[model samples]
Target: MNFNPVEILGLIAAVFTTSAFLPQVYKTWRSRSAKNLSLTMYLVFFTGVMMWMVYGFLIDSLAVILANIVTGFLTLILIYFKIRYKD
Candidate 1:
């Protein structure tokens, strides 16, 4: 297998940024506090992710498609928890 530098960077960035949400998710699950979270931000974030997904579709970029797909779900779950357990 061969790794291009840019692709490696993309993969690294994708992993780091995507994994950033894990702690938030775990903490939220443990404490069930959504007050500090922003509803409007998540709504806009979800919309932006959806748009990224669509843009990926239009451009046919695998990296863009994959990252956005995973991030989108992660974001959606947080949003759901935010709604379900808002303070």
Candidate 2:
């Protein structure tokens, strides 16, 4: 209810970070090609995102929780596509 500058900044940052993955997600989904993606990098990143979500919960950070949840789902989809389309 109270306005917090830090929380506002966090939400703004979350928007940018979460949206950064949209291009890759769209490309992979539309082309069904993930040959250029790194499975290891995604796995690590997803794990980190999940951890960030947990950390967000522990800290009661709504922006972090929401952003990571969406990001994690997108990352998981990429991971799935990577495995499914592997040559």
Alpha-carbon RMSD to native, per candidate = 2.3, 1.5
Per-residue lDDT tens digits for candidate 1, residues 1-87, read: 235687677768778878888898888888999889998998999899889878867876666667788888989889999999958
* Model 1 segments more than 4 A misplaced: 1-3
Model 2 has an lDDT value of: 0.90
TM-score of each: 0.86, 0.89
In every candidate, how many clashes are there? 0, 0
Error of 1 at 64 (Å): 1.5
